[model samples]
Target: MKPSGSLLKIISEDLMPVTEIDIRALAEIYAEENVYLSVYLPVSRENEHVNRVFVNSRVGAIKKVLPADLRPEFEKTFDMAEELLFEPAVSGERGRIIFASAPDSFLHVYRLAVEPEKSLVLDTSPFLLPLARLRADYEDYGMLLVDSREARFVCIRSDIAEEKKHLSTDLMKKHKKGGWSQMRFNHLRKEAIKSFFSEVVENVQGTCDELQTRGLVIAGPGEAKQELMDLLSQDVRQSVLGVIDVAMDISRDELVEESDSVLHENELSTSKKKADELKNAILKGGLAVAGVEDVRNALEQARVNVLLIVKGSSVPGWICERCQNLQANTRPPEQCDRCGGPTSSVNIVEELYELAQRTGAEVEFIEQRDFLDSDDAVGALLRY
Candidate 1:
C-alpha cells in the first residue's frame, strides 16, 4: 500500500522497504518528547549528485548537535539511512529521515514525491507541517462518465485515472412487436435508465467517501449526465466541478487530456481565493500579520491559524531546546528569552513552519507575489 501524504510512519526493524503503516506511526509520534531530527535530502532522478553532496553537507550539520559519546551511534543510524537508497523499490525523488535519542534512540527514513529544499532540523517536536502542506496540494478527484446504456466511474490522483467500476444496461438492440408490446418496451427502457443512474450515484458516492475526493467531474454524450447530476445528493452535487459533453466511449487517455485544463484552472482559482483571504486579513491588521518577525512572533504564541509563506523563501534563526522559544535573532544570546537555557541556531524559516504544524495551523505557499509587498513574504492569519 502507498503511504498517505507525508504522515510519519513506523517500520518493523527487519523490514527492507518502508510501508504505509510505518508512515502513519511516524505521524503518531510527531509529538514525541525526544529530540526530533528531520532531514530532507534530494534524491531526484535528474540530480545524481544530490546523494554525495547532501551526505557531505548534512553529516557535518548532524554531527554539530551530537556530543562526543553519541557521535558513533548517530553515524551508525546515518549509515542505515543511506542504505535505503540502494534499494530500488524504496528510492524516490526526495528522501526524509527522522531521528531522535532521548527516551530511546530511533531513526526512520522514507521517500517523498517532491524534493523539499534540503534541511536538517533538531527540535523539541517533529517537523510535520511541510508534509501536511505537500499532501494538501496533491489532490484526488473523482470522475463519472455515463450515457443511456453504459456508465463508468474513475478516481483521479496525480493526473492518473484508475477505473473503479463500469456498468452496462445491455438493452435490446432491436424489437419487433405490436402497439401494446412497443409501450411495454419503452417503459422497460425507462426503468433500465433509472436503475443505471441509481447505481452510478451509489458507486460515485462510495468512491468519494473512501478516497476523500477533492472534487468531482461528470461527462457523457447526452441528457443522461445532466439527469444523473440532478439525482446526486446536495452535499455530493456541491462537489461537482464541471459537466463536460464528451462521449462515454472515449479512451481514458482522452478523458484525462480533456479534463486536465479544467482541473488546472479550478486549482488556480481556489489558490487565488486563499491568497486573497490572507491579503485582506493583512490589510485589516490585528487578525493577521505579514513579514518574518511578526508572523514568527504570532506562531510562537500559537496564535496563528494559517501561515502563508512565499514560495522558496528561507531565513536563519534560533530555537530554544529548553523553552521551545523561536527567534530570528542574527546573534542569539547564550540563554533563551523564555527560559535561561542554552539555545541553538537553525533555519528560522523552517522552524516557524514546524511550529505552525505543532500548533495546528494550516500552511500555504503563495506563488502569486502580487498578493503582498516583498517584505510581506511570510504571513499568518491569527486565531485571536
Candidate 2:
C-alpha cells in the first residue's frame, strides 16, 4: 500500500510509516498515567545543531517535572526520539514527529515533507492535532488530461502528481473524396469516438475507485475535455472539482500547479457552502448547533454530519478523567460535573476535532471568513 501524502517511514526499530490508519490508531490510545510523549521536531541539514539543542532543552524541562519513578522511562523515550530525529538518513525531511510511551513499550516515528510546529507534550494520549491538520490539507485528487486521441490519468496527493494510467484510441483519417465513402468514414469516426469516450469513462471510474481520490480535475485542449465531461456518470460527475483548458502536452509541473490551484479553490468553495448550510440550519433551528459546548454534545451523540471550525481557533476547557466529559470554560471546576472525578485542562477545539474524526463526521476547517467570524467559531450540522 502507498503511504499517504509525502509521509515517509523513518528507518528505525519500531518506526512505521504514517498513514490515516496510523493516525487513527494513535488517536485511540489512552492511558490513566501521563506516559505518552509526543514530539514534533523541525529539522534540516542547515539547522541540525540548532534542533538538537532545542530538543535537549525541552527534554530537560520535561524531565524536571516528572515523578522520580517515571523520569527514567521518559528519558529513555526521549533518547529514542533524538536518535530518530537527528539521523543523517532522514536529514532530507523537513520535520519529524515521534510518539513514544516507554511504559507501554510503544514508539512511532514519521518523516514529514512539510515542517510542523515544534512541540513536546506529555499526555495520556498522543498529540495528533497537527497530524490531523496535515492529513486534511493533503487529501488526494485525480487529474484527467484528455484529447480526442489520448487520455492520461494522474493521481495527485500533496505536492506530488503521479501518472496512474494512459489511454489512446485510433480513428480513421478523413476521406478526401466528398462522396458516399466520406459519409461512411465520418459515421465510423463518430462511432469510434463514442466508444473511446465510453472506455475512458469506465477507466476513470476504475482509477478513482482504486486510488480513492477525493476530487477530479479535467484538463485538455479544445472540446474533447467537455465531451468527456458530458459523458461522465452521475457518481463520477459529482466528483468533478474543476476544468482547465490547457494543451494536451502540458508539462507535468504546469499540470500539477494548475490542478493545485483548482483543488484549493474547490476547498474554499466547499467551506463557504458548508458555512452557509450551517447558518441556514441555525436560523431555521433545524438540525444544526453552534458554539463549543453544543457542538461537543452533538459530536458525543454521533449526531454530527459535518463539523465546522475556524482555523487556528482554540477554547480553553477541561476533560473529566473518569468520564471523558468535555466542558468549555474559562475556569474549570475542581471536579467534573457529570461524574465527581478530577479534570485536566484540554483545548476544547482540539478535543472536538478528534471526537469528530472518531465518530465519522467530516471536519471542515474554514479559513478566516465573515460568516464564521461573526458568531461562534465552531458549529456542526446534525444527522437528525
Candidate 3:
C-alpha cells in the first residue's frame, strides 16, 4: 500500500478560551493538504477521561464520527447558536493523534472553515486514498537479511554505544591498529564498510522485527545503505519504497523521518489513460450519435465512467411540449409540483441520475476545469 498521508504525526494546540482560538488563527489548520483528522480542545482541559477514535483500519475506513450522541449536524457554524455534535476541540479526551499527509501545522486550522462538515464525516477526502501505496515499505525492511563482503553480523535487541571522534590523528591511529591500513587501505576500507553494515542491519532488524505494526524505515547518508542494499537479496532490495539520497549520521533519526514522510505520487490508472483510450474509441466508432443523443445513449447503458457535457454556468428553464409546463428555479425546482414531472429543466444532475439508474453504476461529474485532465477528456467506466 502507498503511504496514504505525507506528514503523519501528532501535534497539540492549546486554546485558553475564545480569546485564544481566533477564527483567523484556527482557519490556518485547513492549510494542511492531507490532514486526515484534527482533534481540538480548550487550553485548560481538565477532563481525565480518554476517548479514542479509529482513523484507519485494515478492513476499510470509517466514513465519519458521531458525537457520543448523534450523527453530525452540517448546518452549524461558529458564533452560531446550535450546539454542534462535536466542535473541533483543542484536545480530545485522548491526546490528539493526527494522521496527516503534510508537514505543516497551519493545515490544522484551515480545514475548519473549508469543509462542508468536518466532523462525523469520518476520514473521507477524495484526496485521501487507499493504503496500498505504502506497500513499498515491505521491500525496504527486507534488507535485514542481506549478506555481503562486510557481514560480521551482530544481533542487538537495543542499545547503541555512542562514540565521538575528534577527526584527528587519534582517529587515524585507532584505524591503523585495526589493520584499517595506512598501507593495505583497500582491506581497511572493506572492513570499515562491513562494520557499518553489520551495525546497521542488526539495528534495523531489531527495530523492524520488534514492531507490532508496519513502521516506516528511513535509510541514507551512509555506507550502511550502500553496503546493505548491495548484499541484500534481489527481492529485499526492491522492497525499498525510496532512497532519501541524502546522508545522515544516525539511522534512528532517519527511521522517524521515513515513518512520517508521505508519498504524494499517485499511480496512473485506466481513468487517467484518457488520450489513448479516446483515440481507440474513436477509431472503433459505433452507431454514430452526438450531442444530447450520444450522452443519453451512454448514460442509458451505464457505460460512462465519466461524462463531460457542454453546458454553461447556469441552466435555463425548459417548457415541456406535452404539458406546457415551464421549468422553474435553477437550483432545484418544486419538481413540477404540478404534473409530478420535473419542475426544473433537468440539468446534467438529472441526466446523471437517469444514466446511473439505467446502468447500475455511479461516477463523478468533475467540473469542466477538471475535464482538462487527460483522463477526464472522455471515457466511461462502462456498466455491464
Candidate 4:
C-alpha cells in the first residue's frame, strides 16, 4: 500500500508545467524542420483495454501525418511508446506523446499526463494547447500534517502528492523529576516544542518556496495544528486555506481526501481574494488591465504577471499568422495591428494561455466572476 501521505502526490515531474524556454525553443525551430508531431491519448486506471484502443487509434492517426521519409523514425518512437503504454501507466488519466525529429539531429519524445483529448498535429512547433491547459488548470499545494510530537510536509502538484518532510520529536517522552522538578521539565518541554515548531516552519517555508505552492493545508490532532498556524509568518499564513483536525498518523487515503477538500476550498477562497485584488488594481489604474482586449494586449506585450480568467469564460479572436499577436475581436482585420500580417481566427482563451506560458506568467481561473463584472471575464496583474 502506498503511504497515506503519498497517495495524492504526483510522482512524475514531467507533467509539471512545460517551461517558457521549452516553448520558446519549439517556437524557434525552423519551418523546414517541421516534423514535430504531437499525439494525445486518454488512459485510466480502471480500463487498460480502453487505453490500448486509444493508443492504437492515435498511432494510426500519427501514421497518416508522417511523411514517407519520417516513417522509420516514427515507427521506432511508436514501438518504444507502445511498450511503455502496455507496461501499466505510471499515473494520471491522459497520455501525451511529443515526438519531433529535426535537422539539428535532435530526436525527442515525451510521454506525459494529459487530459482526455485526441489530436495529431504536424507543424514547426508542437501543439501545446493541451499541455498548457493541463498545466494551468491543475494545481499544486503544500500540506503540513502535524500533531503534538510529529509533523509531515508534502507537496501535491497536479493531483500527485508526496511527503517531502517527516519529523517526530522525542520531546514527547516523560521526563524525570530530578531536573529541577516539574517546573524545569515543563520549561524544557516547552522550549523543545518551540524548537520543533520552528524547524517545521523553516522546512515548510523552504518547501513552499521551492514548489511554488499555490496554497497550503494544515492538518493534525489537537492544539499543535492551531499553534503551528499561529506561528506561521505572514506570507506563509496567507497561503493557508484552513486547518483540518486529523490524527498525525492519518491513513494515506484519508489524508488525500481531506487535503484535497481543504485545498479546493482554499482555491475557491483564493480566487475571490485575487479577484478583489484585480478589481482594485483596475480601479486604481495601477499595474493591472482588464477586459479581453486589454488583457490580450498586456499578454502580447508580456506584461502579465498574473492572468485571471473567469471560470468557463472564452472569447473568440484572431491571431497574427506571422507574428502570433492576439486580437480579441471577431472581425479579422485586413492585416495584423503589430506587423501587418494576415490574421486567422482562434480561441482567444487558448491563445492567451499559450502566450502566458511563453511569458512565464501565472494563470488563475477565478470562480467568482463578480469581481470581473465590468471587465469581460478577463484581467491581469502586470509586472510593470
Q: Highest TM-score: give the candidate number.
A: 2
Tens-place lDDT per residue, model 2, 110-161, is: 6665567888888767778877776666678899999989999998765556
Reference-based TM-score of each model: 0.73, 0.83, 0.31, 0.70
Angstrom error at residue 380, model 2: 1.1
Q: Relative to the true structure, how large is the alpha-carbon lDDT of every model?
A: 0.65, 0.78, 0.31, 0.67
Single out the weakest 10-residue window by summed lDDT for candidate 3: 125-134
Of models 3 and 4, which has the larger lDDT? Answer: 4
Q: Local error of candidate 2 at 228, Å? A: 1.3
Residue-by-residue lDDT tens digits, candidate 3, 1-384: 112233222233431111122222222122211222333321113422222122123112322322332122211211121122123443212222122222222122211111111121222111111111111111122112222222222121111111211111111224435554455776665676566565655555444455322222234444545666665445444444444444333364343334334221211222244334444554577322223444455665556654432212223333232232433234435445556543223333333333443354433322233433322222343433
List ranges where model 3 is wrong by over 4 Å.
1-219, 222-224, 249-262, 265-384
Q: For model 4, state the Cα shift of residue 357 in Å.
A: 2.9
How many clashes in each candidate? 8, 0, 49, 7
Question: Rank order by TM-score, top first?
Answer: 2, 1, 4, 3
Task: By lDDT, rank the candidates, best first.
Answer: 2, 4, 1, 3
Per-residue C-alpha lDDT of model 1 across residues 1-384, encoded as one tens digit per residue: 112344333432321212122323443343212256556555555544765676667778768866787667556655645555433423322444444433234555555434545665545445554554455454568888889888888876544567888888776656665534777888988887888788888888888888777788889897998899988999999998888999867887788767766676777776677788877876776588887888988887889998887765666777666666777757667888788876776666666776776577877776646755444568888899
Q: Point out the worst 10-residue segment of candidate 1 by lDDT.
A: 14-23
- Cα error of candidate 2 at position 250, Å: 4.0
Q: Which stretches of candidate 1 lie over 4 Å from their true place?
A: 1-9, 12-70, 90-104, 111-130, 157-165, 174-191, 219-224, 243-263, 371-374
- Please give the RMSD of candidate 1 to the true structure: 5.7
188 Cα displacement, candidate 3 (Å): 7.7
